[model samples]
Target: MKKKVVPYLLVSPYIIHFLIFIAFPVIFSIVLTFHKWNIISPMEYTGFANYIRLFQDTLFLKSIINTLIFLVIHIPLQIIVALFLAEVLNQKIFLRGFFRAAFFLPVVVSGVVVTILWQQLYGFDTGLLNKILVTLGFGKVGWLIDPKIAMPSIAIMATWKNVGLYIVLFLVGLQTVPKHYYEAADLEGATHWQKFFKITLPMINPTIFLVVILSTVGGFSLFIEPYILTGGGPLNSTLSAVLYIYKQAFFYYHMGYSATLGLFFALIILSVVIIQKKFIEREV
Candidate 1:
């Protein structure tokens, strides 16, 4: 009895913390999804009203569509760029460590700071990109302010910010591939591309799958870039699901509806991830 009690005592803090923070919030949010409540008001049972309204909400639908658009653009670009960088870093080169650090620096930076920096770079008139374009005899492009370009611009910035972590993931995966396989391929006079396709890619399928799932989830949870850079604007073109939830909860004081949105978003993410896992596992 003493030994068992002592072990439970040792783990009590973690158990208490989990109950207070994680478990409680999740359960409470689920409850809230079926009721209506503002922060200061008594809860009112609303059944599936919030859920029904969510489907009818144009902004909510737009946010979901915008998030999907971001995923479509961000995931492929992230995988390709990160894979390329990882391959480059795997080679023997001068200042290799320096280059790796440089690429990863943005990941360590604050999200707000990164967003602000890009906001400046995406400014219409004096932006660095447009300045260069103007100098090269082209018209200035609206990166963040134009509805047609805002979401894609945010997606590109997001890819740049997060690709470094995936590069390191890919680099580790690349290092794990047995060198003897490469040597055997070289002995057969296989070109670099041929060896990569035949050996490296197949061996690193798990890593590719991981990167895809992580990037997909991250894309769905997007809020900061659109929040800071575009404010979900230029005709709500950059509005993300999470940002819309934030607005509903805090900005509009619709706590119950926000909880419903959060729950639905979680389900959507889970469904997409399940489908992705099946597809990727089959291929791998």
Candidate 2:
């Protein structure tokens, strides 16, 4: 038997790259999760103590709850607004590309830059929102400063920053739906509500699913926006899982605990995805 030289040569680079970059790091991180390291001292194995400690860590628990709150706010808001915008734009409107590019512009900007920009917008004393609220006879509110509202404020910023990309995604999905489906429904004497429920809604399930998964992942990994804007809070209200992990790994120099958090967070993400898949399948 003769192996093909060209195929093997072509794949050899990829194999080497994966082993060096992906495989090795993944394996090393897993090993690192069980060992204590402060970079200067020798690494000492501590079994599952770091993971066990998570249950008793208030900051870690707060981070989890804060993340869930962000997701609860951001995901539904992103989906609804994106879908609504997509539907409006799909109606054979003028300047279609212009609108799409406008919507998707924020996604192209650096996340750090977006956070900075939104921080200014969400400023407690002189923010655009506060000015507008005051102009409209509403009380001047501390959007990013109040502990009760800090996470919600960050959620709003995050949603505004990323909703444009999801709009484009939903728009592309909407375009795939044949026009004749609408025509058939029209001939069948269907109302707008009926057509949307029976035709448009089901047709865009996959897009909705994709947005949900991405929004969920982004929600769980939130750090920069809260960190840059609130430094995880006027209290600890906006502290997130990744910010906590960063503090453990870098700020506090607890590499093993950080790795344990990473592993646990990964499991949480996996669980959410599995649940989403199951729910979607059952509905379908």
Looking at model 1, residue 202 earns an lDDT score of 90
Computed on alpha carbons, the lDDT of every model, listed in order, comes to 0.93, 0.88
Q: What is the lDDT of candidate 2?
A: 0.88
Encode model 1's per-residue lDDT on 1-284: one tens digit a residue.
79879989999999999999999999999999999998898999999999899889999989999999999999999999999999989999899989999999999998899999998899899889999999999999999888989999998999889989999999999999999999999999999999889999999999999999999988899998998888899899999999999999999899999999999989999999999999987997
lDDT of 1 at 99: 93
Give me the runs in candidate 2 sitting further than 4 Å from their true place. 1-3, 188-190
Model 1 CA lDDT for position 252: 88
- Model 1: runs farther than 4 Å from truth? none
TM-score of 2: 0.93
- Please, what are the lDDT tens digits per residue for candidate 2 over residues 1-284? 24668788889999999999989987888998889898889999998888779888998889989999999999998999999899899887899899989988888898899998888887767888888988999998788878889888888888888999999899889988999999999999999879888999899999999899888877888988887888887788998999989988889899888988888888988999899889978876
Query: How does model 1 score by TM-score?
Result: 0.95
